[model samples]
Target chain A: EDQVTQSPEALRLQEGESSSLNCSYTVSGLRGLFWYRQDPGKGPEFLFTLYSAGEEKEKERLKATLTKKESFLHITAPKPEDSATYLCAVQGMGKTSYDKVIFGPGTSLSVIP
Target chain B: GAGVSQSPSNKVTEKGKDVELRCDPISGHTALYWYRQSLGQGLEFLIYFQGNSAPDKSGLPSDRFSAERTGGSVSTLTIQRTQQEDSAVYLCASSQRGVRGSNQPQHFGDGTRLSIL
Candidate 1:
């Protein structure tokens, strides 16, 4: 079974603090790794997509890096507005020739101003 | 719509009732997806539709769950005999296409929060 695991279930950071969230996965064939930010009662917003190991993508204060077995979402100088649940998902090539994505339990990030 | 749009922002009903949630993907998106987000749980993939290809329903938890995408634009997810465990935020997402290596990011909507009584 393809599985994704995220570490540090919850994080509280002071404004401008920097940290990284982790997402580990096991899949047959990796197609893509996605990062999203979801606010309470709202749907997730797409952030980045990492396709291969040693690949990295960034958007404003967020940076996403991927390895063969895991991915990291690094938040740099985060602000209150950046407080949200960060989600990690991996799309893999299935045995049936179809593609399915498996998600990790998100890391709730709270940036206290 | 400019982005993915889902109907019925919130719904509350008895356990035995049936419900239908709808989603309208972006104007030209060729791939649509449905997922369930339970409290404290990660997003669970439920179904996926890509262009005219057959939908992959392998992620659906049970036979009571079904979905359809018509005209390659709008999609609907139906649940029969809704159980208390079914109460969660039903999310819909869309992308430019659904092929491997396309690298299209899925855009989501403010999901429909379902509450079972």
Candidate 2:
């Protein structure tokens, strides 16, 4: 079965403290790996989509990197506004006509000033 | 709409009552998806609509859950005989299309929070 797991279920960091959130996955024929940020009472906001190993994408203080087995979301100098649940999803080729995305239990990050 | 839109921002109803949630996909988007998120959990896929047809419904938890899309633009999810366990945030998302191996990331809407009392 295709599955996704994220580490450090919850993390509290001081402002300007850099850290990384891990997302590990096992899937059949990985097609794309996605990163999203979801705040309370709001749907997830798209971040980066990594298609292959060694691929990396950046936006502001966030960076996403992918490998064959896992993906990492590195947050640098995070601010209180950056606190949210970071979600990781994997889209894989499957027998169904449409591809299915498996999402990991998100990492809740809190940045305190 | 400029982005994917969902109706009934919040719903509170007695158990066993049916509820209908609506979604309006972005213009020109040919793919729509419905997912349910429980407290502190990841999205649980419910259905996927490619154009006006749903090609995948296996993710639905039970027969009480059903959904449909009309005119390839609007969709509805109907939950029958709702139970307390059905309480969750229902999310709608859309992509350019449901092509294989495409890089289109789904755009999401602020979801509808359903509370079955």
Candidate 3:
């Protein structure tokens, strides 16, 4: 089975504070690792997809990097608007031909002004 | 031009009642997925459909939950004899293709918040 674990279940930071969220996973074969941001009452928005180790992707104030067993989402100078839940998921090897993805509990981020 | 869309943005129904949630995927997307999210939680994959093929219902919690995609465009998820545990937000997402390892990003809808009273 594919399992994902996220750290610091909840994080509180003041505006301009920087922090990093961790996502570790164990699966048969890691096809892809995805990072999403979900706000209250809305669906998750895709952030980045890291496929291999030592790979990195950045968007605005957020940067996502992946290793062999885990991935990191670093937030730089967070703002109040960045308050949301950060989710990590992994696409696992399939038995037949179909692919299945598993998600973590997520990191709830709160940036206060 | 339009993103994925879902119907009944919010629903409140008594226990044992049946509810149907609708989802319309992006115009030409071939893969559609249904997921459930509880309060302060991450997404729980429920089902996935690739074109008109048999849907992968492995993630479905129970037999009471079922979904169908029609005309290769719209999809519906039905819950029978709903329980309080069923109250959560249902989300729908669509991607372009799944075959040959494509980097298709799943575009999601706003989601339907169901409250079982």
Candidate 4:
């Protein structure tokens, strides 16, 4: 079975504290690993897509890195505005373009000012 | 260009009543997906439509749930005999699924919040 699990389900950090969230997966074949940030009452916003191990992508204060079995989303000196639920998903191997990717329960982050 | 859009930002219905939710994918996206998000369940994949075919309906919880795509652009998800358990956020996402192995980022909509009384 294809599954994605995120650790430290919830975290609290000071305004300038830096931390990382983890997402581990087991899939028959991995096409891509996706990172998303979701705010309350809103849908997820695309963050990064890591296609292979050792791949990394960064945007703003967030950096995403991927390995064969896991992915990490690192937040650098986050602010209150950066507080949101970070989700990780994996696209499995298949020809059906609409094959739904599996999502983790998400890691909720709270930044204290 | 506008991203994926959904109708009836919120819906309140009684049990046993049928309800329909709609999704308008990005203009040129050929792949669409529907998912349900609950308090602790995360996001549950309900259905997927590539072009006009649904190769997978395995994620749907019951036979009362069904979906269809018309003209390969607009899609509708219908749930009959709604139950209290059906109350959740129905999210629609569109993606350029044709790109193989990469570049298939799913763009989500605000989602329709369904409340079954």
Candidate 5:
């Protein structure tokens, strides 16, 4: 069975603090791994997509790295505006055999000023 | 340009009543998807439509849930005999293509919040 799990369900970080959120997955024929940021009362916004192991992508203060079995979202000097629920999803290759992207139970991060 | 859009930002209905949720995909997008997000839960895939191909409804939890994409542009998800457990945020997303290797990312809408009484 393909599954995605995110650790540290909730995290409270002081402003300018750096931390990392984890997303582990078990799937067959991985196609892509996606990261999204969702704010309260709004839909999720796309962040980055890592297509292969050892791949990394960055935007401003956020950086995402991928591995064979897991992915990490590293926040550097996060500000209060960065506070939101980070979602991790993996898209597999098979639809007739499996569902589409499997999402992880997001990690809520609160950057207190 | 506008992104994906859903109707009725919020809805409150009594149990046993039927409800229909609508989704309008982005212009020119060939793939549309529906998902349910409950409190503290990840997005659950409900249904998917790609171009003129058959929709994949394997993720629907019950037989009461059905969806249709008309003209390959707008889609509707209907729930028959709504139950309390059916209350959740219904989200719609659209992608440019459906090919697995295309790596097309899905853009989401604000979603419709449903509350069953």
Candidate 6:
């Protein structure tokens, strides 16, 4: 079965502290790997999409890198405003899973000042 | 342009009551999807629509859940005899094209929070 898993379910980091969130997946064949940010009381917002291993995408202080078995979301000098639940999702190219993206449980990061 | 829109930002009701949630996808988006997010859980895919047709309903938890799209723009998800377990944030999303390797990312709405007592 196709599955996505994220580690460090909850992380508390001081302001300006850098950290990395992990998203590991097992699938038949990967079509895309997506990263999303979700704040409390709201839906998730798109961040980046990585199509293959060794690919990378960045936005502001966030960078996403992909590998054959996992993806990493690295936060650099995060601010209080950057605190939110980071979500990772993967889409498989198989017949039973091609139409939907399987999402991970998410990592809740708290950047305290 | 408006992203996706959903009605009744919050709903509170008793068990066994039927409820309806609505979604309006992006003006030109041909694909729509519905998902459920329980407290602390990941977003769960509930259904998918291509225009006015639903090609997948396997994600729905029970027979009491049903959804339909009209005019290829507005969609509704109806749940009958709602239970406490049905309470969750219902999210609606849309993409430019089909989800199968289309590389079209989904845009989401704020979502409707349902609380069944």
> Lowest-lDDT window of 10 residues in candidate 2 chain A?
A93-102
- Model 3 misplaced regions, further than 4 Å: B98-103
The CAPRI category of model 5 is: medium
lDDT of 4 by residue, A1-113 (tens): 78999988999999999999999999878988999999999999999999999999999999999999999999999999999999999988755532669999999999999
Which has the higher TM-score value, candidate number 1 or candidate number 2? 2
- Please provide, for model 6 over B6-106, each residue's C-alpha lDDT reduced to its tens digit, 9 standing for 90 to 100: 98899999999999999999899888889999999999999988755545887999999999988888999999999999999999998876345464778
Q: B1-117 in candidate 2: lDDT tens per residue?
A: 598899999999999999999999889988788999999888998888876554589899999999989888899999999999999999999987435545488899999999999
lDDT of 3 by residue, B17-62 (tens): 9999999999999888999998887789999898777889989999
Tens-place lDDT per residue, model 4, B14-113, is 9999999999999988778899999755799988877656447878999999988999899999999999999999999988764573438899998999
User: Judged by lDDT against the true structure, how good is candidate 5?
Assistant: 0.90
Q: Over the stretch B1-117, how does candidate 1's per-residue lDDT look in tens digits?
A: 487899999999999999999999999988888999999889989998888999989889999999999999999999999999999999999987545555388899999999999
Candidate 1 CAPRI grade: medium
Please provide, for model 1 over A1-113, each residue's C-alpha lDDT reduced to its tens digit, 9 standing for 90 to 100. 88999989999999998999999999888988999899998899989999999999989999999999999999999999999999998888776635577789999999999
* Clash list (residue pairs), candidate 5: none
Q: Candidate 5, residues B6-101: lDDT per residue as tens digits?
A: 988999999999999999989998888899999878899899888898888889999999999999899999999999999999999998753554
Which is the better candidate, 4 or 6, if ranked by lDDT? 6
TM-score against native, each model: 0.95, 0.96, 0.95, 0.95, 0.96, 0.96
Using Cα atoms, each model's DockQ against the true complex is: 0.75, 0.72, 0.63, 0.71, 0.63, 0.73
User: For model 2, what is the alpha-carbon lDDT of residue A41?
Assistant: 90
Q: What TM-score should be assigned to candidate 1?
A: 0.95
Q: In model 4, which runs have C-alpha deviations exceeding 4 angstroms? A: A94-98, B101-103
Cα lDDT, model 4, residue A60: 91
After superposition, the stretches of candidate 2 with alpha carbons farther than 4 Å from their true spots are B98-100
DockQ: the better of candidates 3 and 6 = 6
